[model samples]
Target chain A: MLTGVVPDARYWSYTLYGADDYLIPNQDQRYGYNAATMDYVPRDTLNPEASDQWIDQYQIKISADQQEGNWLPAGNNKALSITLRLYNASPTVYENLATIALPEIIKVN
Target chain B: MKKTLIYFLLFCASALVGRTVAIHYLPDYIYSRFSKMALSRPGAAVNQFSVLMAPDENAKLVVKPNPDFAYATLFYDLTDGPIHILGAMPDSIYWSVALYQENTVNFYVKNDMQYDSDTLNIIISDDAMDQEADIEQIVSPEKTGFVLIRVLVAERDEAHQKAISDYLNALQIP
Candidate 1:
């Protein structure tokens, strides 16, 4: 897992998609939740420190029993796709920061 | 009967092995050769404003502001493997980081919880620090490859914009 930082500017937010180009099943409601089912979860509430009796309070499951927000399935055998949307909210003139290309493959194994 | 069963099992195993070998070897051979050629050869960088692609290191990056033109982007090329982004921006600007797969224009992981707007302002203000954002999930199938970092600069003044551009150009994955 690699990490990067985006500085504070005006207004910015990102949206993620799965291999099928659909919104990954987000247990955390922080990312946009499903408007139809409203079955979204938040990360903070999952932590025990943040919420007392966290485990007792809620039982969560992704498409299957994998990581919390892991959009991909278990096993290193399959391929998945991902996408990113960057929104810049500055009131003035337009500015071009960067354009990123999606990876061709993501292997777990 | 026992001999016949053994023969059948052996046949099945051979067939399975053959299929697996074909499935795995063919794609590997094609991809490896194609990627080698693509990386070894020098080609024009894809994005116009600011883009970086390094096949040996297995990374690609693009930095473009939004169409509205409020902020700038620091996208990565996680085509082959993951890459880390480390840097800072001016004080009065707000920014966010996101992960996307190769060839797609969507985010794989949007860090709204960890580094929300309020959190970003504070973190950038206090001191110059570095953070890690894995792109494994976002760029699946690529397996352990590159990541995109989008940095939005608010000030957008002549000096700030120029600084942002220069900073992006100077980015090194190492």
Candidate 2:
């Protein structure tokens, strides 16, 4: 399992890709989820306040098994990489790409 | 032995030539096909930006399809002058315009945050990147190229997407 968080921007999302840069095919037909696609997350899961846009603080979960809130299904036994895209990023966000850090991943019981 | 050596040399020469030609012309061929795809779609026409994806929808604009940002495209010719882009993005949404040369080189790109504009006013030209223009100028290395605009659709707001589409349709090179 892997997890990460992107800073606040007008819009931001992380997409998982195979070694070839193409999206990893999954049964759900979902590649990634942004703040706008909150409906994809299970109802009332995670921080409800982080409902829209890349909030001040939030974590995205990626794993083969189903997890709650912003669950990105990683294909079985396949190596994948994530691409984070920030649209209309502020100077604070874009300039601090190196300085700012993504959230740490923790195993789900 | 002599015949085999001659045939082998000829084959090597032919393969090298074929590879070079493919490398040189393949980009234009691919770009043309994708540019045509953007043009022939419904509501799309030359010089005007057309939204390829609808709200809450995903599609193949050219090859790889993305479900996140809504793609709006324009196939433009700079034989006349420059095409002017003028509009205002809705508040709290992310958007960007990427200008690609007809031969498929991405020459310039700017997002809503980076752009020096409140009401979107930018010029697209092939003359030069530093040309004298009252508004911000985007130089397309090729006289003719494709302009791709991406606007994020917020939630199930089809209305916002429609608004942006209408704004894009109203833009024309003058």
Candidate 3:
């Protein structure tokens, strides 16, 4: 399980890559979940115009089997790595890149 | 017994030499080959931008490409002279331009937030030239390298694609 608060940025995503450094091939054509695809709701009073919409938190699961929310396939017994990309990041995001709260990757049986 | 020991020693010596040579030359050879392949694509040439669609599993031009980004690439060859990049950012989108050396080290990156103006007038060269007014000059470490312009298109919407494409196409090399 991977969980964290989304960074304040115009775009963010978690992409899964296999040991070969190529995207893990899956049937759903789903390799990642970006800010738009994650379907984060507005944080402040459901106001779409509010600037904090991108700051909503997320929980993603990586498994071979189909999962409920924000799932990316683990691609059938292969070593994997997740890459997080932040585009047009805010000043805070850039400055605190090292100290920022990254999503915790928990191994669940 | 003596013959076998000499043979084992010879094998180890060759293995070390082979490993050393491969380690020293393989990355450069691979990058050179990759660059040649990239430049051979349709509409991809020296000093010109080749706009690419959002990356999918088959997109090998870059590793770990973000699907939400529309990319424009320039396989720059600065042997002749300095190359000028003139462009304008599309409104309300995340945009950045990054410079990479032939060895794949990203040397410079400028995002939209860093620029005060929507329009960009940048010059990339290997040598110092007479400073031109109203243009930002960047010295490149390699005469031949790559330029990447990334524009965020979160939804893959048609309007966003068109806008990004237009923005990339408008970059002039004069």
Ten contiguous residues with the weakest lDDT in model 3 chain A: A39-48
In model 2, residue pairs whose N, Cα or C atoms come closer than 3 Å (at least 3 residues apart or on different chains), thus clashing, are: none
Q: Residues B1-174, candidate 3: write the lDDT tens digits.
A: 999999999999999999977777775777788878888887777888888867777877667667777888898988899999997887767788899887677899998878778888899999888899888899999898889898877765678678778888788888
Report the error of model 2 at residue A25, Å.
Answer: 10
| Better model by DockQ: candidate 2 vs candidate 3 | 3
| Candidate 3 segments exceeding 4 Å error | A8-10, A25-28, A41-55, A64-68, A73-78, A88-99, A107-109, B1-27
**DockQ ranking, best first:** 3, 2, 1
The CA lDDT of each predicted structure is 0.35, 0.67, 0.81
Best by DockQ: 3
Ranking by lDDT: 3, 2, 1
Name the runs in model 2 displaced over 4 angstroms: A7-11, A16-31, A35-67, A72-82, A88-109, B1-19, B54-58, B128-134, B170-174
Backbone collision tally, model 2: 0
- Tens-digit lDDT string for candidate 1 (B14-128): 9999998777676566545533443454552312113331111112222221321223233233343444333443333333444333323243444333442332221111122
TM value for model 2? 0.65
Better of 1 and 3 by DockQ: 3
Q: Candidate 2 lDDT, tens digit per residue, B3-109?
A: 99999999999999999878788888988788777677787778877765532213434333455666667788888788887766655466778888756778888
Clashes of 3: 0
| Model 2 Cα lDDT, one tens digit per residue, A60-98 | 677778777667777663566776666666788777888
